[model samples]
Target chain A: MSRHLPIVAVTPFPAAAAHELKDAQLRANLGRATRTIRDKRARVVAEVPDWEELRERAARTKDEVLDRLPELLARFERAAAAAGASVHHAADAAAANAIVAELVRAQGADRVVKIKSMATQEIGLNEALAEAGITAIETDLAELIVQLADDTPSHILVPAIHYNRSQIREIFAARMPGFSAESDEPAVLAGAAREYLRRTFLSAEVAVCGANFAVAETGSLVIVESEGNGRMCLTLPGTLIAVVGVEKLLPRMADLGDFLRLLPRSSTGERMNPYTSVFTGVTPDDGPRRLHIVLLDNGRTKTAQDPVGRAALRCIRCSACLNVCPVYERTGGHAYGSVYPGPIGAILSPQLTGQDAGANSSLPFASTLCGACYDVCPVKIDIPEILVHLRQTGPKPAAERAAMATLSWVMRDRRRWRGALRAARTGAVPLRALTRRRGGTLRRAPWPVSAWTAHRDAPLPPPESFRDWWRRTHAE
Target chain B: MRIALLVTCLNEALFPRAGMAVVTVLERLGHTVAFPPEQTCCGQLHANTGYAAPARELERHTEAAFAGHDVIVTPSGSCAAHLRAHTELPVYELSELLVDVLGVTDVGARFPHRVTYHPTCHGLRMLRLGDRPQRLLRAVSGLELVDLPEPEQCCGFGGTFALKNPGVSGAMLADKCANAVSTGAEYLAAADNSCLAHIGGGLARRPGAPKPVHYAEILAGTGAAA
Candidate 1:
C-alpha cells in the first residue's frame, strides 16, 4: 500500500498495496494551497468582463493552430533561421534528448544551467544529460530543491509541494555540500539554492529552456516565470537550446496579447508575470549568440488527430486547473505518474503516450470530474469531456466490458429490461446479505467482480430497475 | 406553475424522505409538484465511471421523462447538477427552485444548532448553486450556520467510487468528517443526500457523537429535537 502513494510504478496490478499518502498532512497542505489559489483565481478571473469570450477565442485559436501545426512548424523554422537560429525536428523523446545532447557537446560545455521546463522533465533530460557525462544545474528554486533531493516534482507550479519546509531542510542537509537545516524561510531556501547554482550560471556556456508560447509568424519563443532565474539562463549562456512540443506553436506574435494576460492571472494569480522573456532566435551578441530550437512531435500528432481529445492540446499549461482540482489536491502529482499533473494529466498523459503505458490507463479515473478544473481553465479546455473521450479510447478490463455489454444488451429493448429486472430480484435476498459484510459490490465472484469485492461490496442490483416497477404499477 | 419533480433513483430506492421534502416545500409555496412516474436514474454513475456509451440511452430516457414540465426540481444537488451538467436539462437544485423560481428564502422553519454545510462536488462546481443553500438555511431561525472547511472537496462518495475504491474513498471521507468535526458543529448539513449518506455512514460507525444530518430533513421542519 505504501508503494501506491507514488503510483509511479509502471504497473497498476498490485490491488492490495496499501496507499501511503498521509491523510492528515495531505489534507492540510492541499486544503491550504488549493483554497488560496482558487480564491485568487476567482478574483482575477472575475476582473475580466470578457473572460468567457477570451476563453472561447483561445480555444478556437488553439484548434486552428493544431490544424496548421505542420505548416506553422515550417513558418517558425523559416522565421527562426531568418533571425539567425538553427531548428531541429525530433520525432520522439529519444530524438529530442539526442538533439540537446549534441548541442551541449558542440558547445564544448561540461555543465549547463536550466530553468524549470516540463519538456526537459518529460523526456528525463537531466538524467539523459548525466548519462552523457554532462552536468545540468536546475536554477528554478523548486526544481533545484527537487533535483538536489533526487525527488520527482509533485506539482506543476510548486515542484516541491509534497515536501514541506522541514522535509526540504533534510534533503538539502544531506545532498547539498554546505547548507544548514535551520533555514526554513522561503528567502533562506532560495538563498541556499542560489548560492549553490551561482557558479554554474557564470561558468556554463550552454543553457536549456522550454517555451510557454512559440510564435509561428515571428519565430519567437516566450518564457514566463515568477523568478529571474529563467531570464538569467537565457542571457548568461552563450548557447541556448529550447525543446518544445510541436503543438505549442501560435499562429501570430500578436496572439500573445491574450495569453500574456491570461497565463499570469490563471497560474500565479498575478496580473502579469514578474519575468516575461521573449527572444526570437539569436540576438547578435546580447543573449545566447547561438540558439537551437528542437521541434518535438513526441506523440503530439496522434493526440491531435483525435477530435474531442484534441481539445487538450489547447491547454496553456497555466496550472490553474491543477490548483482547483480536488483529486490532484489529495493524491498529489506523483499519483498521476506523468510530467503533466492534475486534470490536464488525466486527459493529456493517456493521449501523449497511449493509454497502455504504465498506469497512464488509470489516470482518467483519478479525477472526480468535479468540473472545478473546467471552471478555472483560462483557455476553457473542457478537461472532463476529454477525460471521458480518452476513457472510450483506452482498453477496458475484460469483466467491465462484458458487464457493460450485458447491461447494454438487456436495456436495448423494454421487454428484456423488464425480464432482467425480474430475474435480478430473485437473487436480491442473498445479494443483500452479502453486501452487509462486503459493502457495495465486492464479493467472491468472477475475475473483475472479485477485484471490486476485494475492496467494497456491491449493492444488490436493486430488486428491480425502475423500468420494471413503472411497468408493473403504471400499466393500466 | 406545474413543476415536475425528478426523484432520482436513489431517492425512490434508498432515501424517500429527501424527495418528499422537496415536494412538501414546493407544494407549500403554491405550486403543484408532479411526479413523472417514468423518471428513473440519470445514468450519472455510468457516465462518470467510463460507461458513458450506455449512459446516452439513460440520458435520452431522462430527457423524455421531463420534456413538457414548466420547471424541474430535484432534492439531491449532486444528481440535479448531474442532470444539468451532463444533459441539456433545465434542472434546478431544490434550493435554486425555492430561491430563484419560488422566491421563498424564509420558510419559517427553526433548527437550532451550529450546522456546517458540505456542498457536494457537482453542486458547487458544475451547477454553480453557490451560497443559495446557505442563504435559505440562514433564514431558518436559531440555526447557527458555521462555515465548513474545504466544503467543496469530494466526500469520497462518488456513487460507485466509494464501493470501487473503498480505502481511498474512506480516507477522503475521514478528512471531510474530521473537518466537519473540527468546526465543533452539532450537525453537518448538505444539499445532497448521496454525499450525506456516504459521510453519514462513516460518522455512524465513527465511535463519536454529533452525527450529521441531511439538509432536507432540517428544511422539512425536522431539526435535532425532531
Candidate 2:
C-alpha cells in the first residue's frame, strides 16, 4: 500500500467513532459481545497460573523471530520445499495478490473455497480474484454472513461480531440460497450456514487459507479455528495456497507449546479449540496434491525498522485487547476503518501502512492510554507505550505545536507557572456565566476546550492554587 | 517522615481541595509534608500529545524541582506514574504513601457517607496500587465503602483524549457515571482528580448525583461521626 492511499483508515478515528457512538443498536451489540468475550477470557486466563510466564516466553520467541527474520524465512522455505511445498516471497500487497491470482488461474480454477484469513483480507486478495473474474466462497460462518450482507468484518476473531442474532438471521434470509428460517436462534442460523458451506467445501477444487504459525524447524504450518471449515478447506482440495505473514514464524517446532496454550485461552477462552490443524507439505494421495506458501511482507520490514513500533509484529490476532479496550467497546471495529481494528489495530495498522498512509494518523490518539490493552495483551506488546511513541513523531499542525511550546514554557519556572495560574483564575472571571450551571465548571468554551466541555464539564481554576495555599499556610 | 508534595497541575489549579486534603491527611498522621512551590506540571500531557521537545523541558523543570527529596508524593496516580519513570526521585501516590510507606491503613479520620472508589488507570495498572486506597477507606470508622461496578473501567478522561475525541469520551463517561450513581453513594472517591473532574462533570448533569471527593479528602475527614 502506498503512503498516499487511505489503506488504514478512510475517515479520521474521531469522526468515525463519533458516528459509531450514535448507533444505539451497534453500541448494544458491541457492549454485550465484548463483555461476554472479556469475561470468558478473564475466567480461562485466570485458570492458568503461568499466564505471565507464557506471555513472557511468547514475547521473547516473537522478538527472536523479528530479530532474525531473514534467516528463519530461509530455513522455513528450505524445510517446506523439502516436504514438496512451493514457497513464494511477496514484498507487498500487489505482488502477493498477483501471485495468488496467477496460481489459481494456472490451475484453471475460476472459483476457490476459502477459509477466513486476515492476510488475504489485508492484501485484498478476494477483490483481486474478483477482478480476475474468479469467485471465492467463504466457508467460515461469520465470514459468510459478512460476505452475504456485503459488509466488512469488524472484530478480528468474529468477522460479524457487530451483528446480533437477528441481524445474522436477516442476512441469511436475504443472501443465502433457499434460507427460509426466520427464527433468530443462533443454532438454527448456524445449521443453515453449515449445510450451504458443506456443499461448497465438497465441490471445491482449490482452497485458499492463512497460517497462524509457521514452524521454520519442521517446515510445517498451523491453523487454529473453532469451526472445522478450515480443516475441510485444508483436506478436500486438490490444490492449496496458504498466505503466511513473515512475522508468523517460530524458530522451532517445540516453541509451539507456549503459543498453543496461549492462543486458545486468550482468544476464544477455551481450553482447546475445536479444530487444531497442523500440516507439512503435500502428502502423496492424501490432503492436497500440490501446496504453495506465500510469505508476505506488506510493510513489516518498514515496521521492524523502528525499535519501539516493532513489537506490534508479535500479535497473534487473538482480539483480547479489543474486547478489554474501552474505546473499542464503545465504538466497535468499523470506527478504526481498517481490516484490523481496536487497540492492536490502532498500533499495527498505522505501523504496517505507515501513519501517513491513511487517516489513521489519528489512531495513536484513539486510546485514553488507560492501558487495559497492555494488561490483556497475550504477547506483551506494550501498546500504550508504542501509541505514545507514535504520537511523539510525524506531522503536527503548526498552531498546535506553537501552543504546546507556549504552554510548556509557561509551566517551566515557578514564577511563570504561578503567574499563569493567576492569569487563568482571573480569566475564569468573565467565563463564570458558562460555569454557573455546572457550578464552577464551564459547559462550553472555544475549539479544543469546547471539545472537553461538550461531553464533560470543564472545571474553572480556583481563586487560590495549591502552591498559593501552601505559601500562606506552611511555606515559611 | 518528611514528604515532598507533588500536587499535580490539575489539582494545584482547579481542584485545590484535593491537594489541601492530601496535606491535611499526611500532617494529621504526624508526618511533615513539604510543597516545593516551584513545582509545576509533570509533562505527562505534553509527552502524550506528541510535543517531545516541550515534554522534555517540563520533565527537566519537574526533576530539578523535586531533586534531593527522599520521597515524593502526589494525589494523582497518573502524575506519580510519570514521575516514577522520568525522574530519579522516588515517587508515590498518596494511598501508596499512607499504607505502604507508613504502614498505616487507618488515618484516624471518620466520614460516615457511603463512598465508592474509582481506581485511576495508572494506579491500577502502572503503579499496581491494588486495594491500598480501598484499605485506607475501609479503615474510616463511619464510612460505608461500596464498590463501583466494573471499577477497572476507565472514566475516559484520557487527558487530551477527552478533548480530542469528546464523543467517544463522553459515551465512556456516561457509562461510568451511571455505574457510580447506581451505587447510591454520597461521595465518589478516586486516586486522581483528573479522572474525578471528568467523572464529576458527567455526574454533575445528573440530579442528586454523589459529590466527587478524593480518597485523601475522605481520609482527612475530622467531623462528627454519622
Candidate 3:
C-alpha cells in the first residue's frame, strides 16, 4: 500500500467519493463555500485586464524552471549557502521528514510553531515530529481550527472551509484553554486564536514554514499569506526551517511580480495578500539566527521525467481548481484521501506517487474532465490533458479492460458495430416490461449498466437502429 | 449544402429520433443531409474512459465514414468536439453548423414549450461553443427559452463517468436537475444527446421532473411533431 507515502491515495477515489457523497453536511458546506469562492475569483480576475498575460508569464517562468531544474536548484543552493543558510536535499518523504525532525531535535526544541505548508503535510511532518515527542502548533486560524479538532484540511486555500462558524466556536470552546465564546463571529474567533498563538509564537524556539515561491538567483523564499500568521512564524522564532518543494522555484526575482498578482487572485480572490514574507537567510538582529531550507523532492524529479506529467509541477497550490471543480465541490478534499485534493490533486497526487502506486492509480479518473480547472489555472496547467494521460497509463481492472477490448474489436468494423447494435436491441427484449413501467426507460439492468441504473435510467433503443432506418428508407 | 450527418452511436442505437430531428432541421434549412452509416461513434466514450487506442480507431472509422464530405454535422456537441480533435474535417455541432456555417440562426422550427438550455461542458469549454447554441435556441419561433441557473456547470453525464463514479455523478446530476426544474421549464434542452440522456435519466427518477430533450428536437418540432 506504500503506507509511508503520505501523498499516495489511501482509498480509491470513487470509493472515497461515494462515502463522502453521503455526508450531506459536508456536501452542503462545501457547495456554498466553493460557489462563493468561484464567484469571487471570477469577479476579481475580471477586474484585471492582463490576467491572461500574467498567467502566461507565470507559466513560462515555471516552465523555464522545469527545463533547467538541476541547474536552478544548484544555483539556489549556492546562493542560499552564500547568504548564511544551510540547504538540505531530501529524496523522498521519509528522508524529508527525518531531515526536518533531526533539524528540529538539533535546535534543542520540543515545540515548534507552523505555517500551513503543503510540503510538510505531504511528508506527514507533524506526525513524524509527534513520534519524536515534539509538538507542532498550527498558527493559521483555519489551520488551527482543523488542528484542534484533529481534522484534516478540506480545502487548500481555506483548509477548514468544511466547518461552519459555530463549528469553529465549538472546537475552540473544547480545545482552547481559557476560552469562552461569546458568539460564532469571525472577529471573535480570530481574536481567540490570536490571543492563544501570540504567546506560542513568542516562546517557540523553532518554526517550520513553507515557501510559495523561491528565487534561484536571489536565494530568497517567499510566503504569500492572508492572515499574517505565517509572517509571525517567519520572524518571531530563533530558528526557522522552511520545507520547500523542489518545484517551487523561479529563475529570477523579477518573476515574483506576475506571481504576486496571480497567486492572491487565483487563490483567495484578493488582489493582494496581506503578508508576503521573503526570507533570504539569517539576519543578525531582525529575524531568526539559524536558517534551514529543506528542498524536498519526494516524487518531483520522477514526475518531471515524464513529458506529459511535467506540467503538473507548475501548480502553486492555489486551490482555485478545487473551488471550480464540480467533483471537488460535491465530495470536498477529504474524499481524495491524499495530501492534495481537487482537480490538481487528482492529476498531481497520482504522478507524485507514480501511476501504479496503490489507490493513487485511480486518482486520475477522479475527474469528469470538465476543464473548469484549466480555465481558472493561474499557471495554465493542462489538468485535463494530464488526467487523461494518467488514466491511460495507470492500471485498469481486468473486467473494464476486457470490456473496452471487446467493444474496440466490435467497433473496429462497420458490420460488427451494426451487429452489436442489433444485439443490444434484441438484448433489451426481456427488459421491455420493465421499460414499459418506467415510461420507455431502462431503470435497472445487468453488470456494465448496473451502477448507471442505480441512480439514473437508461434509454431503450428504438424499434430499429438509425442506420437501419436510413438504409431501408433510402436505397440509393 | 451537402451536410454529412454523424449521428453519434448513442443516438443511433437509443435515440434515433434525435438523428431524424437533425435531418429535419438541416433539410428545412435547404441543405441536403447524407447519413454516412459507416460512422457508429466518435470514440469520445473510449478516449474519456482511458482507451485511447480504441478511441483513435473509432476516429479513423468516423473519418473514413465521411471521407470526402466538406461539412460534417452532429446533434451532440461532445461527439462533434471529440471528432474534431483528431481530424481536420469541418466537424460542426448542430448549433455551429446552423449559426456559423449555414449563416442562419432560425432553423424555421418550433416546439411551443418552456425550455431551459444547458451548455454542456465540452461545448462550453472544449469547443468554446459559447452562446452559439443558446443564440440558436433563442431564435426558435415559439420556443420560450428560459434561463437556467449555472447553465455552464456540467450535467455530469461524462459517458462512463456516470457508472465509474455513480455517487458523485448522481449528486452532480441531482444538482443539475434541481437547477433545471427551478426554472419551471417543461423541457431541459441541450445540444448533446449523451448529456441529455444522463440528465433525462436523472430527471426521470424525479416525480415532477422536466422532460429532457435535445435542442435539435426542439428546433425540429414543427407543431405537428409535438
- Report the number of the highest-lDDT candidate: 2
TM-score of each: 0.86, 0.97, 0.97
List where candidate 2 sits over 4 angstroms from the true fold: A1-7, A430-438, B222-226
Indicate whether candidate 1 or candidate 3 has the larger DockQ: 3
Instruction: Estimate every model's Cα lDDT from 0 to 1.
Output: 0.76, 0.89, 0.87
Tell me the tens digit of each residue's lDDT in model 3 across A213-294.
Answer: 9999989999988888888888888899999999999999988999999999899999898898887988889899999999
Query: Alpha-carbon interface RMSD of model 1?
Result: 4.4
- Candidate RMSDs in Å, in order, are 4.8, 1.9, 1.7
Off by over 4 Å in 3: A1-4, A429-434, B222-226
DockQ of each: 0.24, 0.81, 0.76
What is residue A343's positional error in candidate 2, in angstroms? 0.3
Task: Please give the lDDT score at residue B19 for candidate 2.
Answer: 81
User: What value of lDDT does candidate 3 attain over all alpha carbons?
Assistant: 0.87
Better structure of 1 and 3 per TM-score:
3
